[model samples]
Target chain A: MKNNVKKLSDYIDRLNWEKAPGAAECGELENLYAAVRRVKSLKPPVMPGADFPDKVVQSLARGIKRAKSRKRLLKSAAAAAAVLAVALLVYFAALKDTNIVSAMERAYGRVSAYHGTLEVVFTSGAGERQVQSVLDVWADKQGRYAIGVLEGAYQGLMTVSDGEKVWQSPPGEGALMPVFSETHEFIFELGGEIEALKAAQSARVAGEETVAGRPAYVLEVTPQGGLPYKLWVDKETKIPLQKEGAMHNAIQYTTRYIEITFAESIPDELIQVEGKNFREADIGEEESPAPAGESPDEAFEPQVRVEVDMQAEQAQQIAADSGSSPWRLDPVFTAQVFVSLQISPEGITGEYPVDYEDFTIARTDGRRMKVQVSSDKTEIKAVYLERLVRQDETGIWTVVGYDISR
Target chain B: MNEEGLKFAAEVCRQTWEPLYRYVYHKVQNREEAEDITQETYIRSLAYPKFREIGRAEYLAFFKAVAANLVKDRWRRNKKRGIQVGFDAAANLAFTEDPAEAVGERMLVEQALKTLSAEQRKVVELRIIRGYSVSETARMMGLKAGHVRVLQYRALKNLAVILSKEETSHEE
Candidate 1:
């Protein structure tokens, strides 16, 4: 009998499930094999409940909220000390490059909009690859801006900001994605901010050069803890004609702005999508149970509760656990870390910081939290967790609610 | 987590939840407990700061490890409950009573199958469930025939231990 059991186990191990015992087979061993076969035939049941996905998503939203509040507390505590140190450095450095900095500032200040061509070159295993894209940008003094990507793999991708609401058209997605206001502040507004100039490590007039047949003054500006890049300010109009720099210290890629322009009154249609066919999706929040004494529609808007303070250590732990950098959540936009394009001198090129900042809570209702992140100087991304009602089948007019989920 | 990270995590959950829940349910033997353990696995995974950094295969492995530990913890907690019925008695009762009871007994065996590693599970699923031959299973899983045999041996050995526990509890 023992030998029969051994023989049955060995035969099963050899993938001979269908092989029967000999004419003198032991009944006990045969019963065990039949039991095993019967068990193997039973299928596993599906997840026992419906709320499981919702429960998991809700837990995630809570986790994100806890992480964000903690990060905010840490940032506030550290901001003052860091600001003092940065202020002192800026004050000392400001004296040396006042003239050149002012000239570049004035040049960028007057531009309401610009049309230009961006040509990037980089080295790859096969050698060099050159990518050329048309750059169109519209900026207003009130901090509203729109950028259109007219060529490359990201040719149709567009980002627009109306100061309060930021919208993005991700490549291949015909709908517009509404994101947090801060996302625009981080990504779309270029180096025109005076604070950015004040933050520069050094600024100097490199020399005069002609860019695209226009004579220009090349002002080299190096931000603190950032790469040094040159701006060719047009000699006649004081507008920047070209910009050149290596995007990263680790990767040897040079990016150059080959052409540029400044325009008055950029048409509103270019920045804002006008249609009814788009579908809007919210990425971060999950549907939560409605509060007492409220209609379902009213309860859909989450109420804000008490904020949880987070320390740097907690943020670090979360970041470490999430396999992400803590600096991604920091509001301070450091130039070297945030620059958008990398082009090799050999013309092989790619976009830098391919995604937005690490996940951060843009807003939270008592029930759901919205996760949104701003790109350094190119894109704004939001993870849509909820589906919004839309009018058309082609899914053309997706309107993201900019209102903070209370 | 970032959008990409969240997207990746959502994909992982969508793909692995069933297998993970099945693995947990077999060891724990309660639907609610299995679901709780599965949820805990995901919640615990949130701490793995580089969730997006790892590949799908590595993430699934990590998830299984977490589930297995939870199951072990559950077993340790329930150890003092003592066996309710002898293995032979339960088998006899299952056969004589409602056929539904036999189905329940089969479920216990199915649960035991969940204890196998992903590789072993693949071997069982291919060779046993799909009725593939040894060489065929090996080719499908990209493993050597000898390795497949070893996996099958270990898997069945583990299943035997689980089945034996039922008898041992009955003896107690």
Candidate 2:
């Protein structure tokens, strides 16, 4: 046992000789220790629920039998399969760089790269004007858009855009990601969400059509999964518009480019929207921000972005518990925000106004935001954009961007 | 394949398959693929003569090396076909209790994990999650114990730094 330990140590040392320099003794030491452990493990433990080794041995025996036969059979099939599969793979690989794909990708890129702010208005039955502010714009190559809506400005606040990933207001906002956007493109007011519509297990290019007074190609896209999307593309500009998806609960998007302009000298500032708070994006990392001055409603628009982390409250709580502010959550916005709070850290110390969600909450250290019952409901709805208000330390108040449906 | 080589491969499957399965389960988060790779590791070990000379620790080290290679290869092949590879949808649904909190932690861990190199990530996962000792880890990963310690330090430092930066940005 002593000798084995020394050998294992030696083996371990040799592996790190570059860093440790000249550790021959260590390599042999590791080898000996490894040998001892291996031998010890060979004797199965007496404990209950220890069937792994036996099962492993049995499985291996079966695999050996199967592998031999598989090799023999595959040898014959591989020759034919390799020829066809390789040819197909290469052909598809080559097709990726074609004009058709480029046109489709360009359309998708147009939507994904769109950046600009627009206010969406939903006039309710009572002529009550509700305005929602949109931020950060980007679309996918498939013409799907992800947009971020200002949570405080909208009640039951959430952002919706078309893409594989759907973004919603972070938790504590009582907002769940709406499912309609997943099935329909029109629900979010996105135009031309799909670029290359695949049908019958292939990309389908439907004949020509006219869209918004522009000559366009109507492309039929049938996805193997999810609802199929129908796209209309501008023939001259190679731009697409009006992508409609879903058959059962069909959603249609009508896009009228009110105006189209391209600038070769694209300003970097146009793409950057300072102070926009982005939640965790549904898309993976390397998610592109929206392009400059483009409507957020364009299909494949980039998701709404916020400068502050959404989980600021949880992080604050952790810090409070740990007795140190190891983490801080601050709201980032280009514009100055004014807020009034109902709750405060020192227990109902009245209200004060501040700009941006993170800043407002940071002032109070995550105190609850509530609407006082004594307040007139109608007046509250009309004046205050949000329903609840909370204040942190430093006497800064934040509008609680949450839905108070009840 | 040599007789000893096949025996070593079989022994490797017997000793390391389950933990390996779990390790891969966390990375790709798929049971079917994890099982498939676990089986493949055994079959592959037979092709290398070094298998006969290695013990449990060395065998584990070899298997992990192969598993990492397979994962990259698998991802590339799937990507070529436009198939996105990552966590399975079913895995997300399985979390019913405190789903919000669980999801948050998972995202944080994933974001943190992404910062480490493949080798560093593997060492951290094995030593931290699998509870492998320095000695055992060195043997299984075929690294010197000192190298494992250095990798561990780098992994932890990277995670701490990344998390801290994110927190600072939030606070600001």
Encode model 1's per-residue lDDT on B1-172: one tens digit a residue. 6676566556677777777776665544345566777877776665455555555556665676666665545444434433221222222221222468656677666777777788877787776666554545665786755677667656665666776676577579
Model 2, A1-406: lDDT tens digits are 3443333433323222111112123433333322222222222222213554565566666666565566665778767688789899987676465655476556545543443223322222233332222233333334345443322322223343344543445335333222212112322233323322422234466688765345677767655444455566667666554444322211122223312323333244322333433343332231222236643233122122223333664443443222122111112111112122222223212122232232221111122222212222212211111111223221122233322223
Instruction: Kindly list the per-residue Cα lDDT of model 1 for residues A135-162, writing each as its tens digit.
Output: 3456666566666554332344566666
**True C-alpha contacts between chains kept, each model in order:** 0.11, 0.07
> Which candidate should be chosen as best, given TM-score against the real structure?
1
lDDT of 2 at B27: 35
Each model's TM-score for chain A is 0.40, 0.28
Q: Is the docking of candidate 1 incorrect, acceptable, medium or high quality?
A: incorrect
Question: Chain B vs. true chain B: TM-score for each candidate?
Answer: 0.43, 0.44
DockQ of each: 0.05, 0.06
Top candidate on lDDT is 1
The residue ranges of model 2 lying beyond 4 angstroms of the native Cα positions read: A1-406, B1-15, B24-43, B49-58, B68-172
